[model samples]
Target: MKWMPFSFICLLALGGCQAVPSSLPYADPPPSQACYFPSAASSTLTASVDVLTEWGFSLDASDTRLGLLSASRERELHGASDLYASPHFSSRTSLSVFGGMGIGGRSHLGVGLGGGFGQLPIEVERVSLLWDNHHVRVSRDIRRFDQYGSLRTGRSASTDDFCARFQRALDANTATGDSPS
Candidate 1:
């Protein structure tokens, strides 16, 4: 016999379960829930981008312009709503809060998270993109080994030099904006 009762129960179980949506819709993430950003996100993220650029990426002056464009778009996507909600969002843009949208803020926040943890004091994502997706410092020893290998092969600069160069790039960016991005 085919265990009809068991099959019937299985069928009911399968049919009764609701499909999980691919994404949870934003119904105003509960007001009680505050944003908990991690502390190392900025430094770690800055370090990562600095490293990427130090290795091979070409982050020229035009790259800065692109960063401005991207940061504009990013703000539009992630923090647009937050920005638009505030008339004092910047020293300029006196009445920009009226231009609010939700996507920009979300994009900015998501990108920011990728560089490190989440508690970065500056805009690490924008900095990374502007720096051509490299970082200045590295936490893992193997990464240093990778750089050393490149040097051994005569295809890379010294690790300390790379870090210093990356540091300069990051510093340049930090000085440009009102906030250290």
Candidate 2:
């Protein structure tokens, strides 16, 4: 009887599995969380995204096959971060972090996970990840009202402004005339 397969499985299951490496080439954390985590992270990225958000991603999807289905698969997600980008803000800054998992080896079932972050043009940031061959990255840059705008105008319209606007819209909608029964 060949016990090799059983031994290999035991080793992997017992925390002897090798770690998975990051897929990006960036040297810092992603500037925004929404873009990076969503884009690069594998299917089960919510928890990591939440943590990054809690840590701040405004800085800040899925897979199948190989039985890596998010719906009915037993898996674990791991994430790592370095304060490479400092909590500083410029016209454009970036925060980058990597998230991924070591799916089971030859014996264990498939596990899926991945993530990454990147920013550009001193304002637009894309923090994303890739799962196997799928692209799940996203971008969160300052929304531009006019192409020929100055720093003042650009600063006035950022994710923060959008959030504030959204909040106001929600408040106005619920505060006065509309209430769900």
Candidate 3:
């Protein structure tokens, strides 16, 4: 009856409603800094790059004199729908007969076709390194999108593995006479 159109509109509005922000207070923790290597800045930077590459990250930036380095990697985490794409032709046919004697016949035809694969979710990672005369400092940040395609909070990634591997790499470099006495 007359209420049918109103009900359909309400259903669509409710179904597409956006999620509310949580009332619970939350904050991203500060990036962790650690002096895990006891090698000269240059040597530490080299070792850091090696560790990063070994862990599947490519070198994004580096400064030998400043003892700074950055690396990043990507991984697919989820699937997302592609917003662009078109499907093959689709045909719909409909015929209707009016109940009243005033109207003879009415017809409506609707055809819809859509096709596309959702884009896969990708996690982006970035790692930064800094070193001084006696120690090396490292920090990491990871970025990812939520199901709604909204950029979620970015937080520091684990430095434990990097620290361990960097230590070994620095030790090797020093053994080859790369470290300062």
Candidate 4:
């Protein structure tokens, strides 16, 4: 029959519309680093606070008894100047008006207005340290926020390089006999 060829073509087209998988491969967590110290937990925590402060992070909270220390640092990814330079920073205005007569001779009018403003992004990095008498574990987290202070994205378990650097700093601090008050 003449319709057989057309049916075959339609089947071929439908078969070509297979759905492609959009799933992404799983990502492994970043490596963690631990530093060992010979000093008391309190002393190690104090030195950690000092090092973190030097790195621009302010101590948020700590409990030497529990060997827990938390610090955070915030920096603006876009400054005021950058915000001013953005295209969205310029003042804009939009208006639309429409008038129509219906079948019953009724008149209708509609108007729409819209505007937007630009906002900068801020980055905040946080670090946490836990330690015993001679062992310390450090972890870092990073988050991004909009100018309105709403978090956009965040990640935990930063790379090992940061912990390594902290370890070196702690080593130098202890080696120099910097007593913790």
Candidate 5:
């Protein structure tokens, strides 16, 4: 009859277990920005490249005929000090030293160290510009990578600030007949 308690406890534990919900919805994508200019697509593309370069993005691909441009920028997101302050490093170290004296004495000393040259967080921002005739649309995608080079998080959006800056720059360049520098 003593075993009945153990069986009931096991059953209770099993009943408490729940399957992870797999139907969780993902977040919505960020909004894109579009602007219209009276200038031709080719000129707009050239000016866009110049402005993007000023923003620290390197042109990855461009097709003037198709009015498409792609650029990306990468930057480090964290340093060694940030890594050391993270829980991934702080909570993993363990040290144990035990000594006992008796007929059956046992002495044990152990050191468990965790953490390595990992934990480099990087942020990559990619921008896509598409233009046709006098209308230009710009979208940005941002992704954060963990130390292992795996994507930690990502979002796609074109903020108003970016669109405003791009429009202002393009207007100035196109109006002044200033070629991309």
Candidate 6:
């Protein structure tokens, strides 16, 4: 009978729980086309790198001979309310003293401290990129966990900003290398 309240509370907590939201539906990549600089693979790779760097991504992997490249960017989300519990803000203090002299004296004291609310610190965004023969594929993944520890994944739309810059860079490279015959 004494444990009935505890059991009921546990049941209620479980009943209120739900799974984290699922990721967005996958979308097929656009049709592949010949690169702007068909004969200049080096220039194409350089342009891809430049565009990726301009967009705040760093090179993670690359294979010049194979014409493969990968890049990623990471950032933390800020400005969220602190309405959860955290051990970082919870603390305890204790002091004890005992002495014997002309008269016996003894004293003991203890103290505990904790904050009412804490920040979850669980919002982050990551972007990954892959460069193939004549195309660059980009994927943005967002990860966040709630106070209840439920993790969620989100999808970000394709970024045409980099693509536009890449095309321009390729055009410039090809135009400059060709001289009057």
Report the number of the highest-lDDT candidate.
5
TM-score of each: 0.19, 0.18, 0.52, 0.60, 0.61, 0.42
Give the distance in Å from residue 64's predicted Cα in candidate 5 to where it truly belongs.
2.0
lDDT tens per residue, model 6, 76-161 = 33433243334444312223333334533865454554442333436545544455555545454456654435565444534465
What order do you get sorting by lDDT, best first? 5, 4, 3, 6, 2, 1
Regions of candidate 6 where Cα sits further than 4 Å from its true position: 1-41, 81-151, 159-162, 165-181
lDDT at residue 91 of model 1 (Cα atoms): 26
Residue-level lDDT of model 4, residues 1-181, one tens digit each, is: 9999999999999999998889975324654644333444346766777788888999899987788999999887755333433243332232333345445566655454434334467888988887887677777888887555667777875566777778888877765656456
Clash number for every model? 28, 26, 4, 0, 0, 0
Best by TM-score: 5
lDDT of 1 by residue, 52-148 (tens): 5555443332233332211110111233233223233332223323233356545422211111111111111222232223322211111111111
Which window of ten consecutive residues has the lowest lDDT sum in model 6? 30-39
TM-score-better candidate, 2 vs 5:
5
lDDT tens string, model 5, 83-127?
A: 424454432234333344444367555545545444457889998
**Global lDDT of each model?**
0.32, 0.33, 0.62, 0.69, 0.71, 0.53
Better of 1 and 3 by TM-score: 3
- Minimum summed lDDT over a 10-residue window in model 1 is located at 139-148
Worst window of 10 by summed lDDT in candidate 5: 90-99
Task: Report RMSD (Å) for each prediction in the order shown.
Answer: 22.8, 22.4, 11.9, 9.4, 7.8, 11.5
Ranking under TM-score, best-scoring first? 5, 4, 3, 6, 1, 2
